[model samples]
Target: MNNRLKSVISAAAIAVGLCFAPVQAADLPHVVILATGGTIAGTGATSTTTVGYTAAKLGVDKMIESVPELQKVAEVRGEQVAQIASESMTNEVWLKLAKRINQLLAQKDVDGIVVTHGTDTIEETAYFLDLVVKSKKPVVVVGSMRPSTAISADGPINLYNAVILAGSKEAVGKGVLVALNDQINAAREVTKSNTSTADTFRTPELGFLGYMQDNKAHFYRMSTRKNTADTEFDVSKLSSLPRVDIVYGYANMDRVAMDADIGAGAQGIVQAGVGDGSVAAQMMPAFRDARQKGVIVVRSSRVGNGIVARNGEANDDKEDFVVSDTLNAQKARILLMLALTKTHDTQAIQRMFYTY
Candidate 1:
């Protein structure tokens, strides 16, 4: 055939192939679901089965099966990274999960990612992912208040909303978020507020970032917190973190526990202090000693809603401790642990506390 005739035939063939090729659904977005076992994956025989049943039973496939509508919202794929209770989650587990999220977000075809986690420590994991996973695509962490076997099980709806939030364009570049009870919360500010209520997770200070309605997610506020993903610290550079412990303060508190944790080689300590983040008079010396010995000390209020004071208390100020502004005790612990991985300098760590 002549060269011009051959070109005409090739163009016709290409046009025919384009017409036959599959097109993505009109409203659907490409979403990757990373399932790490939590209450959402737990199974129980009774209504009060919060602590009575097997965990990690649902896995990713079964979770997607329970929420078939997710398929309509996004081209969903599942990968089970772990199947442990949220309480059993550790720094190593977080590192593995962050790495997986990084890999998924790197894919051009993946528009977003959703994580199924247990409510017990979901906030911690969510915050950890927010800090470390460097992705412009949305990263949503979700869990249910009740297990699948319980009456009025909330996992299906929560999962459905999670997929919708993950697939939404508004979610992009919003840092990591936790979608639960129809509320979209910033990872840095959200925390588990109740044990049994469906509305368990909340962002006390800044309120929710947004919410899900009519199969779509709506946003009213944006997160301003700086994160590891947006910082100089790289996730790949983190391997293992130094030991960190949460020390609670109460009347007649024993100093032995603080000493014990420090003696046990804890590299970081978070003090869940009384109102205004006050450490007990007796525990002050032990905290100072720990700080002097090179352990990073962070003061966080157990009050749940207010900032821990930094300069008013003489002893606390003298210890050169970092104060968590408005972050609850547990969240402060997670931040301290992550910050320690990057630097042990108290000043730099303090800046992290203020910023993230």
Candidate 2:
């Protein structure tokens, strides 16, 4: 065979190989894993010791590599956003995470996002993302009760399922989802019920969006609340979120916490009031003064589940306070912060509680 003839045959072979390529990037949905330090990456001194372990021992690359099954569902990429326990989570980190998510989801090539976070504050981060992420692409936040070194570390399976959910077209517009223990929960409803358990994340009032069965997500209901693409929140230009604090109510609770929070320049305060969202007689004066200082006072029940009813008996009508509709204290704080960004009117804030 002459040199020219040999080259011609090689070109034909190359064309044939290109046509038979195993997997094309365009054919696969691109899924990015934004890993923040949590129990999912934690290291235990012994397999039996679940608590008192070192968290964030593993990085995003190792986490993705450990879950080989993830590749079977979608092409996974990872970026370690933070390596600290969620207890150390700050407003700075929240902004960074939301900004990164918005950046990625804006890309035409990216299909979905999966965030690995600590179970302690995963619900907060999920709710923030649900409100701020402007895309219809799926965003799944996942965490584990056990560290990576545990006997039956729940991180791998949770992560695999999260990737599966993120890459699915059906998951779009369902808002940010918390996937763990084979369950799918909307960010607005889910909460950390148990301190140390795989099934800790639960939505007491509004049950889970669906469950993970047969290693696949089976969604039963979609959230009706405004979220994701429906929400007006955009964190792309947010340098810092307005300060909001929660005041837990108790039997003998005084207004010390509320006073201190207002003194510290809290733009909004969520009163984790006692049953039925009633403020103690002693705390009323301080709350009134807070509302006088232009601080948005929102009423939410400390008790889990159930919506804090609007008007009636709580003096909400007279005091002009906002009521959190089905949102707990922490979640109410999240909503109030976003609401303050848009408006300061109590009526407007109340409508936000109702609609969002």
Candidate 3:
């Protein structure tokens, strides 16, 4: 029991204990972040200037490094899908992202996915994945209203919460989720409501599925919408989605917009109409004519909430037009575009609005 023997025994014991200790980071779920540029990746002249900023200026590597807390929750990896404002996000990009997600999820190493998208169209992208992604693994879409350089920027924390949700067992089979502003919104239920605030996204009709507290996902409810593996639509084989446009209906709005969309080769048009999804007096003729010419017309409310009843004042039944249940115009447009990829039947399309 000399000093040298005592030191050797202590070193051996310490090495044995180290071998038994669990490596927390290595044991966590693996999440892949697909970064599509938005305010989250934006850069401004300074922290005080928020009105006009250059978005998608940062790449995936820089963004992943910004939130160090992400390492504690999951084994995160970053992939740059595109670096463009959400408004510039196109259908071609959607197909590419969806296909890539499917490919990644097929790997044994991937447990979930987190998509960093521009807030402008995050809902559309999330819902599209809900319909087409045929997996039970969690897919959380996240975005921020303020640029990364803004004062009190919400990007870092939002991205952190998104990673938390993607790693959570509670998020599986729950459709494509939208994680932002401490709220967990189902893709089918959430919409962006404000142009400049952290709390821009809201679920007006159905409300959020849950909220994040203490850096974890707290599930309160779940959506019954047909999404993820339950959805009938598939974008895997689709090379491109048909051209669908939105036509806003107002007090004196004319058929000019609808006519123009038809001229632009719109295969489907989402009419953001008045109360109860009613088509304006002057626009009904154009809608009917478009329906005759193989253009699918979907009546959705601009009022933000409530269902657009089938066969209601919009004359959806007689006009052979479809109705969007509670989908806002943007979401309605996404669904219509995906639905057209499957079938052209009016009843089938109507069923899509009701079920999805």
Candidate 4:
């Protein structure tokens, strides 16, 4: 055919193809998966070997590629944020991750975010992001108990459900969510209950926020506490978070740990005390010393669930200490770190513990 006829035919074909194309990718929700190495990205020696595996073996790209069904739910993309196990998660990584999420969610095209984290500290990271993200766009943190290379590797399905949850409009403004084993949990309340099980993450007392079933997210309740955009925390300019340490309380526990943390320049201390957040008599002196030296003290329970009532076992009023309403020791530490950045007043920090 002549050049003119060939060009005309090509243009016509292009136009026809455009008209027949399914909805463009731009029409779909743009969900970014930030991979912060965990069991979800882990690999085992054999399919049946669930334990004794290596973590952070796979990258975000590989995880995303393994889940083909994710494309139908959202415009998926992945970024490898960190390749460290969640137990080794540091404040530096937390700050960097939070800043990145805030930046991504601020873009008009980015609808939500899915974070693949280790189950060990996924809840802590999720709660940290929930308080500091400053965006209503859904952020779902998902992980797996089994390695991605296991026989029944739960990572792929969990990752898929996370993307679905992140892209859902109903999930927005409900705070950070933990999606795993077909369950949806609020970051503020979820905890890792089992060491090695698919259904490890749980909200024992209040129950999970919802579930991921039928390839979609279902919500039964939302976090009433302040979170996400509602929180006043801003980690944009922060290079590092305050030094906060958790001291586990036990029978005949001494103040050595508390004193050590204080001596090491801990800006805040979380007492993972016994029932009702009680402080051991020996630890009380160190707590008082910490308070005298301008270190914030927070009373949090080691128990799996329940509130650490203020002024119940410990004299919060006399000691000028803060109580973690429903926050566990680790989560309380996270909040106290952030709270220290804004204020040193015990009452203000205590209010943060209650509200956030």
Candidate 5:
């Protein structure tokens, strides 16, 4: 054939190939994994070395590459949001993360989100996102007690389950979720109950939201509390959150820590008190003084489980203090921080403690 004829035939063939090219896969949900440094991305000296490992050593891309089965679960992608231990999770990172998630969930193309966080503060981050993310799409926060390089590391499976849960229709409107040890836990109720175990995160009283059984998500219960799009929290415009501190109440407790926190410009304080969130008599003066200075006070417990009922042990009404209800000290701090952003009135903040 002549050169001109051959060129025309090649062009036609290329056009045919273009027409037959596979369209983008629409069956799988597009799930984004946002990695904040935790044990899920940690590295150990050997496969059997679970502890004494370096956390946040691996990046998000490395984690995504480690789990090949995730390809079948969703249209997966990753972003390294931060590289720090969860114990060191800062308010700045929390605001940044919540803002990013809200922005992503607002997009029509993004179907779900998975956050890889340190187990220490995984519940905190999850609850924080649960209250701030303004979408019904699934937002699962996952972490492994074992490092990725440990023997029988749980990161891969946990991550796989997280992606699966995030992409599931059943997970929508379930509030933020925590997926680990083949279980799905609501962000508000789940807490790390063990120090070195795969099944550490648990809902001590309320129970699991569901499980990742048969390689799929099976939900039996849903959180009744306000969350996600239901909350009025908007962190998109704020650069910082109010400083909230926690004080542990014990025998012969003093007011040094309380005074220091107040002096440090704390806007609110959560007292992780004994049995029923009792405040030490010695510390009451400081707490009252803090309240006088327009600082909000919340009564929470160190007992791990049970409600810190209003007026049960402490005269919350007379003290002009707020009760944390079922919220633990750390969580109370989180709610109080967000609450102070709106109103400083103890009555208003107390109402928030009940609602959120």
Candidate 6:
């Protein structure tokens, strides 16, 4: 055949291939459901048995099967990442989930990913994944207040909302989010506020980032900073991290707790300080001494809301501590622990606090 004739045949073949390739659904977006056992997968005898239930009873497939409405929003696929309560989740589980999210995001057919997690440590996992997974696609973490067997179970609806949020164009590149009780929250700011309430999870200071309504997700605000997907830190490069301790500050507090953590070989310490992030005077010398010995000290207030002030504290400033800006103490501890994996520089740590 002539060169021109050959080119015409090749173009025709390419056109045919393009036409036959799989297409995303207009009614349903392609979604990957990564199920790590939580309340959503738990089973109980009675409605009030929220805490005393047997967890991990329902696997990802069973959970999806129970909530068939998820099919209306996305083409869903399930992977059982772990079958344990959220309390049992560890750094290993976080690494495993991050790796899987990375793998799924690489696929052309996948539009988003949903993680079903236990409420106890859902925020920690969400925050961990938020800092690690590098994907522009929506990654949503969701859980339930009631078990599947309960009369007023909230899992099915929460799962459906998560699917809607995951598939929506608005959710892409907003970092990892937690969709619960019809509210959309950034993973970095969301926390489980109540043990048994349907409206348990919330982002206290910033409020809900968005919400799912009318089978669609509507965004009221946009996350301004770069997160897991856009940062220089590589998720796959991390292994096990050093031990970190969170010490709560209170009135007339003794320095024994701080010294205990230091003596226990804690590589990092998070002080859940009193109001406005102030530590008791007695604990100041111990904190300063810990910093002198090369331990990382981060200051976060025990109060549920507001930023920790960096100025006007003699011992706090002397320790070269990084202040938690509007993040609750527990969440701040998670961020500091993860940040320590990369660097110990106080400036870099403070920059991370501001950005994320």
Relative to the unseen true structure, what is the C-alpha lDDT of residue 204 in candidate 1, on a scale of 0 to 100?
A: 83
In Å, residue 103's CA in model 4 sits off its true spot by 0.8
Residue 285: error of model 5 in Å? 1.2
Displacement of the residue 120 alpha carbon in candidate 5, Å: 0.7
Q: Give the Cα-based TM-score of candidate 1 against the true structure.
A: 0.90
**Total clashing residue pairs per candidate?**
0, 0, 0, 0, 1, 1
TM-score of each: 0.90, 0.92, 0.93, 0.93, 0.93, 0.89
Q: What tens-digit string does per-residue lDDT give for candidate 2 at 1-356?
A: 99999999999999999999787656777899999999999999999989999988899999999988777678889999999999899888999999999899999889999999999999998998888998999999999999999999999999998998998887988999999999999998999999897789888867899998776789999889989889888778889989999999899899888889888989999988888788888888998999899999999998887878888538787999999988899989998998888999999889889988
lDDT for 64 (candidate 2): 94
* lDDT tens readout by residue for model 6, 1-356: 99999999999999999899755455468899999998889999887676688877899999899987777678998999999999998878888899989998999889999999988999889888888888889999999888888887889999999988888898988999999888888888888887778898887767889888888888898666668777656658667766788999887888888788889988888888878888677887888898888888888888788777776444445568788877777777777777888898888988888887
As a whole number from 0 to 100, the lDDT of residue 114 in candidate 2 is: 97
Report the error of model 5 at residue 85, Å.
1.2
lDDT of each: 0.85, 0.90, 0.90, 0.91, 0.92, 0.84
Higher TM-score: candidate 3 or 6? 3
Best by lDDT: 5
Task: Report how far off residue 40 is in candidate 5 (Å).
Answer: 0.5
- Residue pairs clashing in model 4 are none
Error of 1 at 29 (Å): 1.6
Ranking by lDDT: 5, 4, 2, 3, 1, 6
RMSD of each: 5.2, 4.8, 3.6, 5.1, 6.2, 6.2
Tens-digit lDDT track of model 1 for 1-356: 99999999999999999898765585478898998898899999777676577767888998898777777778998999998988899888888988888888888888999999989999889888887888778999999878988888899999999998888888888989899989999988888887778997888877998889998889999878776468555677678877889999788997898899999999998988888888777887888899889999988878888777777554445678888888888888878887877899988988988888
Query: Residue 299 of candidate 6: its Cα lDDT?
Result: 82
TM-score of predicted model 3? Answer: 0.93
For residue 12, model 5's alpha carbon misses the true position, in angstroms, by: 32
Those runs of model 3 whose alpha carbons end farther than 4 Å from true positions after fitting are 1-22
